[model samples]
Target: MTTISALTVPDERVLHRHELLALGYTPRRITAAVRDGSLVRVRRDRYVRPGTDRAVAAAVRIGGHLTCVSALAVLDPEIFVFAHDHVHVHADRQASRLRGPGVSHKHWRKSEAGDVRLSRRRLTEPPASRHLLAVGDIVGQLVRCLPEREVIATLDSLLHRRIVDEPFLREVFRALPARYRRIAERLDARAESGTESLLRLLLVELGIPFEVQVRIAGVGRVDFVIGGFLIIECDSKAHHEGWEKQRSDRRRDMKAAARGYCTLRILAEDMFHHPEAVREALLGLMAGHPRA
Candidate 1:
């Protein structure tokens, strides 16, 4: 007579074995559900509702504890998920395997023990002060972690004070994909903006020649210039707010028009969420101006 919907989780995405026990599901029932494809095992003691998201399920099934970027994103859904290696429970000595793929363990001393949480069976993030970071945050942090010669020194000053631990920094470098390793080497942490970084990468992929942070005749300095006829501006909403930015952008557009250069404004949302649309728009715009 116990309906699964009768149960509730502290975090909708995370679930613990004891929570299921409290719900009257015995080990036999749990195993039966798995056999019947009615439940998915996340970790040794964890079972998530069948067909749950892979990341959530994995977090539950491999529940020694997770921290760093994966934990941060899982705990704070506002942050986007990008990195692959999930930081997991670690002791000074190697422990028995927790039960899942894609899990990375770090040997934490007792001082780092209480950092992991088991709320509803899902992994959670450590405090920001504890040197945890997300993918976006890591991109900025790497500028300082790598030697000055490895990346531009300008980036060091930008990220030197920013929080990223030595371990997570090493993980990112080791995990860097072959395709992105070269780009990683060229990253400058003090570059002033993620929008600028993403835009530059896109432009490079698009084969558009341009200058960054250069002043136009009337529009002052834009993010990029293409053929001196197009001005590209990258805006991050977190940095821009209210009617004031809108008005300033409008005036800048007018000035660019007066100087005979076309203006294209790219927002962070457009870049991350609607990349295809942005790409199509850029393609259409460039159709009129073939590459020379």
Candidate 2:
């Protein structure tokens, strides 16, 4: 078996067979490297280093580019959102259907033919030769495809990361159908995670007036200050998993309570799974407190 280190080519983890041939690697040497487990065959023509990202490999296997929330999550895993349940790929409208347990194919539409071309022509940041969609196109597809609450969370994440500015996002919103335009208008960059964004959107729909990221005199900064004296804290396992964080959060809550603020801690699961329970609890609190 040939040594992979001996073959000098582009440094990218994922490489096309044609690229290797052009870089002076003979077919025999490439085959030997694959046999020796130095390279992994992701698809018929695509190869990647061992343990490459499954999502990218799936997209390449499907003969398309990653788009929508799948691309965004790959770009920034730190931003809290729902777990990416599948690999999302954008392919030609007439492309053959793809089959897999966790693969979702998004077919290009006739009306989006021009937009598709534009997305392909424009080079995305980091220059993803692995066939990831452009940021703009990804955002456009996300606004059109994802639910309203999810769209708000995604836009907030993009804005927080400065991936797309307000003006550019406004253009994306305008390009969407009229029904989705209002949803974009409700986006708040202050939302630190998808769960927080969803909670805020639900509160708005419930006609509850609340302040976000409010800094109380004793409490540093609360998630959502509702009805003036009610503080709603949204927590996730990522942020509040450890004992230290739990202790800190309890201290904050106690300090707020001492100052007449009723603090309610809402977990990520509560916000996503049992939203009705959350809504009913919020309504009860609002009714008792009455915004002062």
Candidate 3:
């Protein structure tokens, strides 16, 4: 009779410590398996089954989990892009020093809130108690957990607080989904990109028919276009660097302008910190050039 313990996927995570002991596999046995290339140690107490997805196998072997961006991607690759780094797992700080190569662990303190807690895929139980979450639940967990604005805020705060170095923050940011290209323009409003997101949102709210990220003829791409008549550009200082950038931007604007495209550039400060100004400017721009 094949028991649950006996059932093997070769790649499934080794769950509990007792499971390892139950197999009656001694260190000599493990060493022999390693020598034979049949077993690979993922962490100190973790061994991966050959031919399985390394991250999933690593997660299972460690009896922890793959969470954050990696989990998001595995759960919904379409929505959440994969981060090409260590599989992030919530683990004890002490156990990590003893972990094998390539397995990155993040310490979970009680101070952390809804952020890390959002992406936990419940450990699979026996068949009788299984209740899998829906696709919507997965997506919702990822989106609400991210909240682009919050990422920006965290970045800004990190600098302000001088708590950690930029390198660390960069790694953390790199582990996040860059942008939702599918709903980028519409959801921009939901993001902290302020001008870009808000302008897109307001235009949608105003029933403006516009194409996002449309490339212009003999000119660079515009942020969004209204009925092929007007071009909208959302400029945040975070994206623009210096005078050379200003000159390059002007050149692009000139090209669009020469093509009889009325261009409007909305700044980030104006869009978010002062939204009324954005509304007024957008309203004036729309009024002058009615969408045809």
Candidate 4:
């Protein structure tokens, strides 16, 4: 039996029986703490103080660490947009099959010649089970795991919030295959939201020349300015759905019109669900205003 002391465990509040024993705690004392409600068993060997993050608890329950978008969300919930309902977990390729409610398991396969050097790189840090993949590793996994549009949106969010710089993202891109490099090239740090980033990507795919976060004399700052005279507003519900915001938007549109700019406001639904309609409307707008 190993000697244990209260001073040996750091303040993280999670502990394993082995750790407690090494710190001079007896098995009897460990049982008493659990019985008295001072420690909660997360699993067979893992114990944590009450009120740990449920997602972290879930990751521990699945016997893996959070990675990809799930890790990004945990690292910075303010900026990273992890829209999926399932909690993402990362485990070794040879690990046993994972089964649980609301868990998305990602197996780390051996890295190929062109794949990111996931195995060789020190992208993971650990206390064994509760480890988290580094931000750069998460970004690399994101590109490989998510759709291209989603990758752009996530990267744009990361860039816009200055959570990660362009150089760091370029490094992440370099870890990818040649075909995936275009995503890095198209990234813009000025995008204010995922919707704006998605809209910008759509416009680029349409071969439209645009400027982001353009300011007009009367209108505050428009999302995107195309051909120097057309204002495109990608309206996210959280920001633009309120009556006060709608009124402010109308005022801005009128101000833009006075300054010889035509405003096209595209809601989240229009841009996401009816993208072709958005394309047609943009084409129509461009054709009607040749100067724009």
Regions of model 3 farther than 4 Å from truth: 1-140, 144-198, 268-276, 290-292
**Residue 189 of model 2: what lDDT?**
78
* Per-residue lDDT value at 77 in model 2: 66
Compared with the true structure, what per-residue lDDT tens digits does model 4 show for residues 69-91? 77667666666473676565665
Which segments of model 2 are wrong by more than 4 Å? 1-13, 22-24, 93-128, 290-292
What's the TM-score of every candidate structure? 0.47, 0.80, 0.43, 0.76
The segments of candidate 1 whose C-alpha lies over 4 angstroms from its true place after superposition are: 1-180, 290-292
What's the candidate order when arranged by decreasing lDDT?
2, 4, 1, 3
What overall lDDT, based on C-alpha atoms, would model 2 receive against the true structure?
Answer: 0.70
Q: Model 1: how far is 137 from its true place, Å?
A: 14
For candidate 3, write residues 1-292 as lDDT tens digits.
1112111112234433345668898767777876887876555555656774655554443434555444534443332132235464433233433222233363333243222232343322221101112222322233345555333332232233333334443333343356532232223222233345556556766677778778888997777888778887888786776999989888988888898888788886776667677778767777776555
lDDT of 4: 0.69
Candidate 1 lDDT tens digits, 57-87:
4443443333334443444443333333433
**Cα shift from native, residue 120, model 2 (Å):** 13
List clash counts for every candidate, in order.
4, 0, 3, 5
